[model samples]
Target: MVGTYDLHYYQIDQIKRVRIVRRSDGCYVQFCIQADRNVDIQPAGKTIELDVGLSAFYTDSNGLKVDNPRHLRKSEKALKRLQKRVSRKKKGSNNRKRAVKKLGRKHLKVSRQRKDHAVKQALCVVKSNDFVAFEKLQIRNMVKNRRLAKSISDAGWSQFTQWLEYFGKVYGRIVVSVPPQYTSQNCSECGEVVKKSLSMRTHICKCGCVLDRDHNAAINILDKALKQAGYQLSTVGHTETHNAWEPLRW
Candidate 1:
């Protein structure tokens, strides 16, 4: 929605409203089971739910907000161990070949784990919500941050969008994108945009509102989408708490 992009409207459905917000998972939502199943392939619209193996309790003065990601400790440990083992093995030797294979498998496992986690979360978002919000990623400019390119790629925004598209169609959800021009620097509460470097993670508006930069951007995206869908600004936050993406409780 932020950058140069187009929505391929496959079903020719009319969008009543477009609200692009961040992926929010309720308390006790997880996706490890969906990831662990030894199925060769998964069918689309076949909604499967599970606990992602973590407990989350995030709140602020406003109320409970987004759940922090969990289940990454094990994967991080596995990756470090594999990297160390690969380092000690003789290069181009049989032992090195075996080490390389082990490393590859670890990477595969990590990849699969992340994919499973993302899909379940995305699907939950599709099911309980209407207007899905996201930054129109300027992927090219994003990739230009050479140091962060790999991690950003790993975050899989595009893949999440792709999955959102599939689930949106399946559940009759409307997807919308807004100009991602200033979702971060601009305050979602107040219409103010400031040019800040990427390192500034906190958005402090002179209007006496301070918010985490990423979250500020996320809600702004939702605002933009709703406007495009012809909804008045007053109705935007009316259902914030009641309309949360609640998946299977752990």
Candidate 2:
């Protein structure tokens, strides 16, 4: 067989198995290699929480927001054009087949883009902190909301979180997922349940605590993770009831 393949990097480890799969664009080979991937990374001695959102990719506990790429939204115009062409072509015809192929290739491009973005962002987050906390979001349930479903899917939260966990394991960092309940509604400072609609971007509490909604939620996520991990915060010092916390399984 005559074919071309691009090897991005070479693996020195023994290959356990290989598989070939066909995609819209091309056929690709995947290698399952056996090797120890663990690496030594100096502890940053810092913890962070991430709140994923449609408005921004995520807001960190330190008040930093990463803008959402909206990959599908950006490519929707081209995809629509290709799809229309496919529909216009007669069924069981060469023209229709070509048009469909074009549409499929465009979709494959968007998928790769999402994966790239997720991998880079997740690696950065894992490398920057010793402990990472995020919400245990039920993405399947969230996508049932027709009004916000597209936006949620475009954010690629599921892919991002998967990468975060993978990188955490490789780098020997802790990535924990806490319950999503009331993280956004509860005030981080005073523990008051300040109810606000989705339109309300800022969180304001009666106890003189004001913060951006996502920022406040990020802090609350961190707190929840720490408490769950048996860490007690005090003004003078910190106390730990346990030495380690296990990452939640998906």
Candidate 3:
């Protein structure tokens, strides 16, 4: 069996278990190793809240927008071609089986891409901030809308959040999931309710807080999380110097 084993580089002294799986490309062997590693948590660091969406992968409290690399959407045409090719093949034929395998491989590639992106992005976010806050999104319920179901699924918010939580546990970071209620409706600067429809992208508050809806929500999410964690906000007025946070186009 062809395999990759580099224990010296990993400093893996003991193998506890191993599992092998066959894929369309080749066989994959997973090794479970036992080793000592140091995982330290910083007590004081920058806090950030994220508002995830289809417009961008996530908009942070710092107004930084991470572009969503929609892998499935990008490969949709190729996937459709592969599916069409498979449908045209005769049942119980070798060609049919090969076509199916090719389709499966393409799907596996997309899944891997989504997972890789989520892991890297989550790791970076967690490492940069001591406390990470985000909306507790109910993806299953949200996807019930037929119009947005495809886009919501393609965003892979659940996968990204899972990795964020996993990494948070591993690195001893504080990850908080706040209630989604009024996060967008409530003005981030003036504590006023700025009601808006789903079509509204900009949050225009009567109190003079004009900002991107998602960016405002992100700030509110961070504020809510900080309050829950006993971090008090300054009572100073919402001056530009105090509340200069706004979305910047990349």
Pick out the ten consecutive residues of candidate 3 with the lowest summed lDDT: 241-250
The 10-residue segment with the lowest total lDDT in model 2: 234-243
Per-residue alpha-carbon lDDT of candidate 3 for residues 190-215, written as tens digits (9 for 90 to 100): 89998898779899988888998899
Please report the candidate that would top lDDT against the real structure. 2
Provide TM-scores for the models: 0.61, 0.88, 0.83
Per-residue lDDT over 1-250 for candidate 2, one digit per residue giving the tens place of the 0 to 100 score: 4435333344655667889999998887877766678988887666778999767999998889999988899999999999999999999999999999999999999989988998999999999787888998999999999988998888889999999999999998889999899999999988999998888999999999999999999988878887886664332122221234323221
lDDT value for candidate 2? 0.84
Per-residue alpha-carbon lDDT of candidate 1 for residues 1-250, written as tens digits (9 for 90 to 100): 3323233432334333444433222122221111121222222222111111012211221222445343345577887888899899888899987887787777766666667766886777667655455556676687798976655555555666677677766666555556667666777677887666777767788888777656566556666655665554455353442233222111
Which parts of model 1 are misplaced by more than 4 Å?
A: 1-84, 87-92, 235-250
Q: Which candidate is the best by TM-score?
A: 2
**Root-mean-square deviation of each candidate, in angstroms?**
14.2, 4.4, 5.8
Give every collision pair in model 2: none
lDDT of 2 at 150: 92
lDDT of 1 at 31: 19
**TM-score sort, best first:** 2, 3, 1
